[model samples]
Structures are given as structure tokens and as C-alpha cells.
Target chain A: MTDSAVMVEAKGLRKVFKGRRGDHTVAVDDLTLTCRAGEVFGLLGPNGAGKTTSLRMLSTVYRPTEGVATIDGHDVTSDPESVRKSIGFLSGNTGLYPRLTAREVLTYFGRLYGMDDGAIEARIAHLAQLLDMDFLEKRCDKMSTGMKQKVNIARTVIHDPAVLVLDEPTAGLDVLAARTIVDFVKDCRTRGKCVIFSTHIMHEVERLCDRLAVIHKGRMQFDGTLEQMRATHGHDLEDAFISVLEAA
Target chain B: MNARRVMVIAKKEFKDVLRDRRTLIFMVLLPLLVMPVMFLGIAKFAQEQQSKKQSRTLRVAVDSNVEPMITALADQWMAENSPRLMITSAKIGLSFPAAGGDRKGLGTMIEQVRDMMDGGADAASLADLDPDLVESGVRLAREIDPADKALFDDASTISTFRTKTEFILIEDLEPSETRLPAGVEVPDDLPESWDGEQLARAIQDKTIHAAIHLPSNVFDMLEDQRASVPFSVFYDESVSLSEEASDRLAAFARIVGNGLLEMRLADNGLAPQFAEPIVFEGADMATPSRRVQAFLGGLLPYMIIMFSFFGAFYPSLDLTAGEKERFTMETLLLAPVSRMELAAGKFVVVFVAAVVAAVLATTSLGLTFTQGILPQGVAAGFDIQFEPEAVMLTAVLLIPVSALFAAVLLGVALLARSFKEAQSYTAPLQFIVILPAMAAMLPDLEAELHLAWIPFLNVSMLMRELLKGNYLWDFFGITMLSMGLLTLLTIWGASLIFRRETVILRT
Candidate 1:
């Protein structure tokens, strides 16, 4: 465990959304983090604190403005396709095609990941049981929110990606659905898959994170283990999170 | 670009969009149903209206100054041209001098029929022949050799020329209200006097269908065999019934005057040719299929182009803007496919939808015409059977057109943040496409060489020419080049948009 290789890393990552009138918005000014295989990393920040933007850059969903980020040793910018293939990304904004059934959505991503038909069917069968998605034949639109989230997770991990980047995956889920995500994150850690989970909930951070980073106004404020964060700020996780934001 | 990734994306998008009821409705149902219903509805409605107008009895107020002799002349014309009288005249071999086509052959046939009618018949009194004798004369005329069989062709057309117009002439205008024909109503507040301008006012107000004014000495002029007779008919051209009344009155006058002139020529021992200095018979050389092609050439292109645009419209929006709205775009972006592959995938689906819609609509329209769905008269004229080569070329033209629509719509729709917003952006695209696509429908708009360079208009005009069996190679080359370049340009633009993080992640 101590010698586990780094699975996800970012250094001085930045993203600036430029408007048409030459104005620019710095969504993530400077972000750096690292997560090793079998480690669960938590990104903690308030709303609009660059968590989504930074994670998106790492997942290769957004191009970094100025940064070096890699998934499974593939640079996000230089080798986006490889980086994307290595990582499974999910967020509050990521959605399943409503008209597509759970199995269809999974198969679609499987094929996009370069899996053959036989491999795709095997992967779908494996993921279907792993997620308990018995409603694989049902359309996403007809599924409950929990069912949809399960389908979304199945789609994310359809290729059995090595690293999972989940940006606020439990943001709007009910307690049961949120527990499903919690269990999934823990399961990924047990399977030796690197998991980067972003959320503002201190309870979730306390329960799941092996190491964590706190960002504020597009800049990193803190990066350390739970013991280190508590020792530096406060013993209470919520108070420590607040202290990090207040200090920044 | 990975072909497999593109295929995967395209396959998924096709499945996803096909499952949508809206896409199926636009892509299949509407195109298949609209053509036949609209065409048959319009044809049936037009026929009914025309028949209704033909059968209605129009009321024409004849001024007191109109001579009773004019009415007598009309009665005489109707009697002479009645189907029974014409049939009797035809059977007696009493052909008019004005009748054309092998005049000498008809003269010899008339001679033989007259001798067959009676051993020594007075030719001038042939009209006084008995009905049974006339019937026997017809059978005898039929026994002539087939070379002379052409004479009976005119006999069949004579009955079909029966006047569809039925006019009720009210001669006494002093008590205008009381003198009006039954079922004819005029406003009670009509002007007290039916004066010069008031007569026209009554026609305009729908109080009367038409007004006829014959010169006071018209009867005397007719008795003297004057070369010219002047008359005036006042009616509103804007009102169809009024216009028909005026036209029918003039036609009646012309027929009676022609009969009088023919009698005058006979009395002077002059041939009818002496009166008519010039005669022309137009020979239309176009076959039935060619005539149908001439009409469908203008219309089919407009329908095919417009429907193809519509077919691309919904799917393009659903795949692009709808993905953004549903937050599924980020999910798609997470795939290892390049933005170009993604765009190409969606573009292929949209292109197929466009082409399928166009082909279905065209096939449905072709079936409607060939299946005799239109009224008998209209259907009989439009038994369309397109040449295989022309049809194949026209279908090939749709490839570039559908590609253009799919690419342009995808690009434009991607800029929108929501499905409704995309609709707002793309709905107006119809007008932009329609104006150029409708170029073929303008009858006088020639397919000039320069027109072959304009994108949609070029395809439209070239398609028209192709459907009419014209293979203008230069125009075809130019249109293909222009359209291919435009499609490639738009597809490049769409892929560029797809590559933009801001657009893909918008909202």
C-alpha cells in the first residue's frame, strides 16, 4: 500500500473561461493534487470554488488553461484520449441519454472505449451485477433518480477505468441514493482503483477520504491527510473545513 | 478520426433519437402522410367548386334598350347547336363549309350518303329528313371505308361542347326588383334608377351577375348583314360569378354571329375561307409523361428540399442542444472519441434522417400521383413515370443537400443552450432554406448557368432540370462542386464548434 503507484496527479492546473468580448473568468487559478492507486481523495470546497473545474481538467473534459494533469500516466492535454480511457468521470452535470436504456448507454461507452462486441457484452454483464441494475432494459427517462444514478455510474465505469473522478456525484441524491454512491466509492478503493470524490459535505469527507484538498476562489488552500487537516485547523471536520475557507 | 468510434457514436445516437416519438413523427409519419392528403384534398375541393359554379344559373339584367331580336337570335343559336339538331345534321351528311380536315373527302362522303339516303334527294332540304331516315343515314355512313372513319371523331366531341352556362335574362329593368329572376336577390336599398353607372354598381354589389347592352339598331344591322356589330357587357372581374356571366354572354354572341356569317357567305357563294384569312392548329408534341414531368419538375424539388431540411431540424437539435440541456453532453465528451468523430457521428444520423424523409416524401408523392389519388381529370393528366437515369441523378443531388442541412443545423443548434432555444435558432433556418429551395417553383425562373453556383438554389434548379430528363453536365458538375464544398465547410464548422469546451459544456 505504501508503494502504490500514483494513479492521478495535477500540478499548477488552471482553467480560464474566456468570454466573447475578450474578458476572461478564472474558474480554477492554481490547483495541485495527487492520488495513488487504492486511495480515496476528497476535494472539498464551497459552491463555485473550482472543484468541478479542476476535476474536469484532470478528467480531460475541459482543457487546462495552464497546467500538467495526468490520469494513469497519460497527460490530460497531450494524451486526452488515453487519459479519458483511463478515468471514469461523473458529476452533477454528467447525465445519461434519457431515451437510451441502461444497457444501451453502457454499451455505447464500451464501444467508444474501443472494446469489441464480445468484450462489451461481458463488461455490461459484469457491471450490471456489480451495480445491481436489474432495470437495464428500462429507459433512463423512465428510471427513478436512484436508478438513473446507478445507470450513470454503470456508464461511467463501463470500460472498468482505473481512476474514477466524481465531482459532487451525491450532490442532489436522496439519502439512499447517496449511500449507493458512498458504497461505490469505497468499493473502488477496495478494488485498488484510484477515486477522486468532490463534495462540500464534511461528513462524507470524514467517512471516505484518505487524503483531501480544500480549494477556495479557484486556488488551493489546503492539501493533507484527515489527521493533518484536523491537527492544523481543528478536530471537528466541519470546523476544519470552515477554518480552511476562512483562512483563505 | 476513428471510424469505429464515429460508428459507435452514430449508432447510439441513431438508437437514442429513433426512440424519440418527435423524431419519428418528423422523420417518417408527416412526410408520408402530408403529400397525399394535401394533394387529394385540394384537387377534390377545386373540382367541386368548379362544378358548382358551372351548374349555377347566373342572373343577367338586360336593359330595355336591348332589342327583342337579340333574344330571338340567341334562341335560334341554342336551337341550331342543340345536341339533337347537331346529331341529325351529322347523320344527314350535311357538313358545314367551315368544317376543316379533308374537306374534299368529306364532300365525296356526303355525296355518297345523300344518294344512300334517297334515290334523288334535294340536298338543300336534307335538314328536313325524318329521324328514322337520319338514323339509317348514320348506319350507312359508318359502312364507308375506315380511311373515311375520321369524320365521326368530330361527332363525339360535339356533345362534350354543350354550353355549361345557364343564363336567366331579365329584360324589364324599370321594375328591377320585381323583374329579377327567382332565387336572385338584390339589396332593397339599391339606387332608385338603374342609370349608366348604377348599372355597373349593381353588378359590383352582387345585385346582378352581369348587364348586357345591345345597340338599338342591332336587329336592323343584322338584317342588313353588317360586317361589324358592337355590344357592351359590364361585370366585375373580381367576382368569379360576375366574370363567368360576362364571358358566357360574349361566347354566346360570338357563336350566333359566326352562324350568321356562315349563312351570309353561303348566300354570296363564297367559301368560309374567304372570311377567315388565317387559321392555325397547334400540335402539342409532349407525351403524357413529359407533361407530368414538366409540372413535377418544378414542385418535387421544393418539397424534397424543404422536407429534407425539416427532417434534419428536429434530430440535429435533439442531438446537440438537447444533450446540453439534459446534461448528457458532458457524458458524451467523457468518451475517448474526438470532437470531430462526435460531430461526424451526429451528422451522419441527421443526414440519414434528412435523406430518408426526402426519399419517403418523394416516394409517397409519386405513389399518390400514380395511384390515382387525385381527381380523375387531374390524375389523368399526371400519370408520372420518371426515367431511371433522371431519378437516380436527382437522388444523388440529395446527398449533398442532406449533408448541407445536417451540418448547418448541427452547427447552429449546438450554439443554443436548450432545446427551445435551439428551436428558435433553427426554425428561422427554414425561411433561409425555403427561399432558395423554392426557386424551382417559379415558372419563369430559368436555370441560368450562373444559378448553378448558388448552393440550395443551384441544387433546386438542377434537380428540376434533371427530373425533366435534362442532364446538363456542366450545371451538374458546378452544383455538385458547390454543394460538396459547402457541406464540407459546414461540417468543418460543426466539428470546430464541437471542439469548443465552452459550447459543449454550456449550461
Candidate 2:
């Protein structure tokens, strides 16, 4: 793996949903962060704290209402198609077509990513073996939660994107499914791919994150490595998380 | 914008939707089966009702003096026309040329005669055929003795009005009931009294189907040629059988009156030509095939428009709102393709589905008519003439309509958050357009130029004109251009919704 090189950047990104009756609800507010190649960046927040919204903007699923965000140097707003091509985004809102088999789902994403048929097939074969997904022929609707999560991860990395933005990828998952995500994150780091994953689990953050940010109420409260966090807010990662929230 | 990406999405969507049982049922199974089953069922029911009507026996009550007069006139007429009636009835069998195949040399003669009749050839054209062939055809027809045999063996099976009439003395009718059935209202214009009032009452009570009362005049009335006959037939028009019996009795009275007129004419030493000064011989220009095409053309547009909408209905919902409900819309949005590309991709699939459904439905219906699955008489009515050019043009006209349906359905369905919600949204859409789509069914509504600018109604009206072989080029161009513009607008609207994160990701 190469030395860290910034691959994802956000500057004062904001999203406000306009209601039908001329009301406004600010979802993500002026959040700034940078994630780099060869490292895992953790985004930590409480429920309704704009984690998914921020990731969506970075992935170009939603255009930022204000400010600039870019993936692999392509602006989310100005060059959203390019930004989308550079990143693989997964969230609670991101789901597979239930009627499509796992292989079909992967192939679909691969083709959408502009991958040729031979490369798509080769990439699918490699991911299937790596993810230990033997039931590739099974429809997504028929698969178990663990199996579906495996397919979801394969679909995410089918194009071997430069960056992966996973919003609570392990939420509601059993330990086995959660481990698959953990291992996938480590594999991405080793391969020098940028990964920005959001989670509430402190142990996962402490174990995998090279750098981390804690967002509270859509504003960044802490941005540093785990060692820096431990030194500033004590050794307990859970206490540090509490300290970060209290500081905010 | 990116055709390859759009096609990839469309191809995947097709595969995904085809696996869905609901989509398969609406998209394929229903279109294939609905027409044949409904048409056959209706034809069978109609046949049964017609046979029942034909076999029903009717009763007639005749005034005392008119019975013998009518019986004697009937006897004289029967003596003159019975042999002629047998020959004519036997000639009905000659329509089946298959019967003529049994005798050597008979088939060719029958073929020539049928060719002449079918071609609408006049007597001048009959001179063009070999004289011996014409003579032989006539001789073969005469050889079948009218008293013993018919040309076709299945002559007995031909359905005709065989209503049996039983005459009773009008004086024997029971007293008028006077009371109407509960809730039954009579028109206020009914007279207080009439000559056949008693017989009219018996007819109303269902004791008899109908009653006929004739003038009890002396034979001295026929002495004057200018005298108007006061023969009256009483029947309850509301009752079908009673109305039928009344019609037959009135017809018999005309025959008897005509016989009396002939006697008077002969006694006065005048010719029959004095009684008939003018006559009309009407002939229709439309071939049977053209007539059927005109009839079906009116119906075809309605089916095509509605079924095209229905075919696009489920898939659009499943592709848009269904994707939202399943949480797949976000994933699809995250792909490299633009919102326009995505919308276009999904639109293509839905459009193809709409076109396919309409084509299948119309094709199936057309085949059902052409295949002779309906009862013979009913089948004969559907001798459709589908010119290849007309069919291709009709299909061309359907394209913009189907595109409009796909785009609008996709746009509407995209707003809903779930499949059931989408269904509720789209169901009313069909009903709203149904009125405009059924414009072809209005017989008096001419295909006016201004109407060609309307959306569903234009296609409906224009398709009818096209199928009837009326290629109104200006109307076709107007409808096509207008509907195409509408389709492009709707597709643009759908793409706008696709680009909206709040709508695409609506939970």
C-alpha cells in the first residue's frame, strides 16, 4: 500500500429538505472532513445526526444544497457522474432488487460502472470467492440477512471503486455479518482504497479507524486519530465518545 | 443520454419484472386470454337466447268473422306459393358449394354460379360464362326435387323464425284484469276503450302472447278499391314474445289484404302495375370484410389505449415506487448513470411493455375473429380485412400513445412511496382517460380535424379511421406529432422527479 493520499474531501457541505408548505428542515450542516487512500475513516454520530445525509452527498446520491464535496477530485455537484463513478456507496437506504439474483445484482452494478463483460465476470468471480458467497445464484429476497449483507458488500465493490462510503454498514447485523464488513474494510485499507464508514460501535472504530470524526447535530465536534482522541479524552473509547459529545 | 447505460438498466429491469408473478399476469396472461374468453362466452349466451326465442309458441285471438276470411285467403295463397316456397327454401342449401362436390361435373357449375353471385356480377356478365356451364348449374339446382330433398344435407339445422301461432276467438278472452302489476306504470295516453280491449287484456295477463282483431265487415266492403281497411292487432310491446307475435299477425293480414286487392283488380280489369308506381332496389357498396373492419376499428382503439395503459401500469409502479419501497432506488441512484439516463432506461422498458400488451391484446382479438372460434353466424359478421399497411400504420399510431402512457404512469407512480400506493394512484388514472379513449365508440362523432390534437381521443379516433382504411394523412400527422410532443413532455417530467432525492428516496 502507498502512503496516505486524500481521496475524499468535503467543505461546508449542507442539505436542507424543503417541506410542501414552505418549511425547511436542515439535515446536514456545514460538515467538513477528509478521507484518504490506504486508511479507514470512521464517522461517528447519534441517530438523526446527518451521517447518512453527509455520505449521500459525498456519493452524489443527493446534491448538496450548499457548499462543495468531492470524491476522487470530482465535485459532487459539478461532476456528479464522475464522483459517482469513483465511489461505491452503501446505506440502510441502499438495497438490492429482491427479484434479482446476487450475481445479477453484482453484474448490474458492474455494467452501470461501465465495466466490460469480461472484467465484470472476472471481478464478480474474485469477489464471490473473497466474500465467501457461495449462493450467488440465489435471489436477494430469498437470502438470509448475513447472506444478503454479503451480496450487498459484493455489489458495493463490484467495480473496485476508488472510495467506499458505507453508512452504518453493520447496523442490525449479527457478529458474522458484522465481521464480514470489518474484514472488508481491512482488505480495502491493505489494497490502498479509501473507506469512509459510519457506525455507533466504539470497538469497531477503535479497531479499524486510522482517522475519525464525530459529528453531532450536523457539526463536526472531533477530527483526529484514535491515539489523539485517547490522549485528549482518556483511554476508554466509550468515555472518549461521551467526551466528544459533551464537548460539542 | 447514455444509451448503453440506459439499455443495461432496461434489460435488467425487464429480467427483474418478468420474474414477478403480478407483472407476468397483467403483462402476458390477461392480454392473451381476456378477449377470446369474453367473446366466446357472450356469443354462446346470445345463441342460446336466440334459439329459445325461435322455438317459443305464440297464441293469437282472432275476431269471429275475420277467421274464415283469413283461412280461405291463406288456402288460396298457399296453393299458389307453397311449391315456390319449397324451391326457394331448398335454394338456401345451394350456398354451401361443398354439397355440390359429390356429383361429377356439378362442382364446376356450382363454382361458376357462386363466383358470379359473389362477384356481384349482373346478367350481362353472366353472358361471359359458357352457356352450357350456366345451363348445367340451373339444371343441377332443379334436379334436387323441392318436395323430397334439399341440396345441402344439413338444411334442417338452419335457424329460422319458426314461432307457432294458435288462433283463438277474440270473444272467448277473459274479462280485462284492469289492475296493473305492482310498481308498473302505464302511459297516460292510453285510450279509455278500443275494439280489441278484451283481447288486449288477455295479452297483458300472459294468457296469450298476442291478440289480433280484424274488421267484421261484409264482403261488400271490397267492392270499392279506395276503402281503407280497419284491421287492428293488439299486443303488449313491452313483452318480446307478444311484440313478435303481433308483427307476424300484422304481416299475415297484409298478405290477406293483398290477395283481396288482386281479386278486386282482376274484377275491375286493371293491371297490377297500377298498384305499384315506384320501387327502390338498394345495394350496399361496402364489402362484408370492410364492414367488419369499420365495426371492429371503432372498438380496437379503445382496447389498445386501455390495455396499453394497463400493461404499463404495474411495471411502472414496480419499477419506480416499488424500487423506493424496496430501498433499491437509492442504490440505483448511486450508480454512475445520470437521472435522465435512469428515467429513460425505465421508460423504455415500460414503453415496450405497453406496446407489447396492446399489440398482443389486439392481435389476439383479431385472431379470435379471423379463426372462426365464434358461432358461424357471429363469426361471419367478423370477416375482417386487415390490410398490412393499415395494421402497420395503426401500430405506428399506437407508439406515441404507449409512450405517453409509460411516461405518465412512471411519473405518477414515482411519487407514491409503495406498490399499493402506486396502484391507487394509477387506477384512477385509467378511469380518467377512459372517456377520451372511448371517443371512437360515439357513432355520430365525426373525425373532425380539431379533435386530432387531443391526446387519447385523437389516437382513438385516428386508429378507427385507419383500420377502416381511411388513411387521413393530415389527422395521422397531427395526432402523431401532438402525442409525441406530449410523451416527450411527460418523460421530461418523470426525469425531473427521478433527479429529486426526496422523491426517489421517499420512505
iRMS of every model, one decimal? 0.8, 0.8
lDDT of 1 by residue, A42-63 (tens): 9999989988888889888889
B1-507, model 1: which lDDT tens digit per residue? 989888888888899889989999999998999999999899889888876665454666655555243444433433443222222223221222222333232233333333433565443234344323333333333442233345543433322111100001111111132332212212223344588788877778878787767777775787777547776787899998888777666654554455567667867999879999899989999988888888899899999999899799899999999999999999888889888899989999999999999999999999889887877887886776778999999999999999999999999999999999999988988988889998988879988889899989998998899888788999999999999999889888888888898887887
- Alpha-carbon error at B144 in model 2, in Å? 25
Q: Which stretches of candidate 2 lie over 4 Å from their true place?
A: A1-3, A226-248, B53-282
Per-residue error for A211 in candidate 2, Å, reads: 3.6
The TM-score obtained by model 2 is: 0.75
State the DockQ, from 0 to 1, for candidate 2: 0.69
- Note the chain A TM-score of all models in turn: 0.97, 0.96
DockQ of each: 0.72, 0.69
On lDDT, the candidate that comes out on top is 1
What's the TM-score, to 2 decimals, of chain B in model 1? 0.75
Query: Candidate 1, B3: how far from true, in Å?
Result: 1.2
